[model samples]
Target: MTVMTTHLESETAEIKRRRDPFLIILWLVLVVFALLWVAPIVLIAFTALKSNAEIMATNAFTPPETVAWSNFSGAWERGNFATTFQNSVIITVIKVPLGLMFSAMAAYALARIKLRFGKLLLLFFLFGAMIPFQVMLAPIFTLVNGFGLIDTYPGVILPYLAFGVPYQVFILHGFFKAVPKELSEAALIDGASHLTVFRRIFLPISLPVLAALLILDFVSTWNEFAMALVLLQDRNMWTLPLGLMSFQGQFSTDYGQLNAAIAMTVFPAVVVYMIFQRYFVSGLTSGAVKG
Candidate 1:
């Protein structure tokens, strides 16, 4: 009994020793990663505080003597961020939900229902995802213009939905397949219609996937420049990205103000990701593994 207990104690100590080194290495790696990720943002913040002269003279690594709270306000007003922000909000609000619903519905149909040409339909959507956005730009522009949608909100927004839906459908099909069939069947037996089952059972259980897609779509739509640039010719209808580009001129650049504007453009998306981060990871992993 004493010998056996001693051996067990020795094994436990060895396990701890092995785990301790791994833990230390993991912490060190995470610390390095965090610094690398954070360094650029920190530099941007620092530059935003400095005057143009200071920014040009000093090393970017150096900290400013004082925080320039006014830089944010100036960037907001001068950059026409108010209008840009509203444009982004309107586009995102309309596109994100529409994209999610359409994609989710398509994914559910593909994953759950038996239909003629279902595999072909899914393959078509996947093929759409593989097509480069640049290749379709000319055709999309012509389509939007033929409908007289150029320089219009719907022109930019509708094209976004059309392009974004395929990938969203692709991701969500995996998630839908991962959902247990019994729950859906049980709902059906309870006299729940397909719509009702989707609303109550599938949606509630699939919140993580939904949340993940929302963030992903929001980020993509918010940062989108090419389509917004080509479609929206009117300055009044400019998104944040298009508006930020206005700061650059042929003569000279305002480095301090430009960096501040760039930072402002990135801030909202970062806040959103931080808020929904947990669901984002869970949804992505769950879909990938289970599908």
Candidate 2:
């Protein structure tokens, strides 16, 4: 019994010793990555607080003697963030729901339905994923212009939908395909119509994927600049990204104000991610496992 206990104790100590090195290495790697990731944000925060003169005089690595709380307020007003924020909200509200619905419906059909050309359609959308946004800009702009949608919200929203839909479809299709067909068949046997099965059965099981896709789509639409710049010619219709660009001029740049504006622009996305992070993580994990 004494010899057996000694052997087990030695084995346990060996296992712990082996684990310690890996744990130390992992923690060191994480710390280095954290510092690298956080460095830019730290710099942005410091720059936002400093006056232009102070920024020029002092090393950017050093913190300001006094935090410029007013920079945020000033940037807010100067950037016309109130109006730009409203525009972003409107575009997001309209585009996100519509995009999700269309993408989900298309994905469901492609995944579940039996059709001669369904695979072909899926391949076509996959091809779209490989095409760069810049490649389609000219043709897309011309088409929007021909439709008299220039300088309008629809002009920008429509293009966003067109570009965003293919990706949404691709992601959701994999998720939908992974869902057990037994549940769907059982629902149909219970006299549930196709629409009812989709709404009541498929949707509930697919919430994780849906939530993940919504967050992804919202972030993309919120940060999108190129389409907004090209489509929205009017100041009133300009989204936050386009409005923020107005802060830069030929003569001089408001570095403090620009940093402040950037911080604010980034704030909403951060807040949204925080709020939905739990669901986002769970959904992504679940989708990956199931898919």
> For every candidate structure, what is the RMSD over all alpha carbons to the true structure, in angstroms?
5.6, 5.8
Instruction: Candidate 1: count the clashes.
Output: 0
Using lDDT, give the best candidate's number: 1
Q: Per model, state how many residue pairs clash.
A: 0, 0
Error of 2 at 269 (Å): 1.1
- TM-score of each candidate? 0.88, 0.87
Report the lDDT of model 2 for residue 274: 79
lDDT of candidate 1 at residue 159, scale 0 to 100: 87
True-vs-predicted CA distance for residue 179, candidate 2, Å: 1.5
TM-score of 1: 0.88
lDDT of 2: 0.83
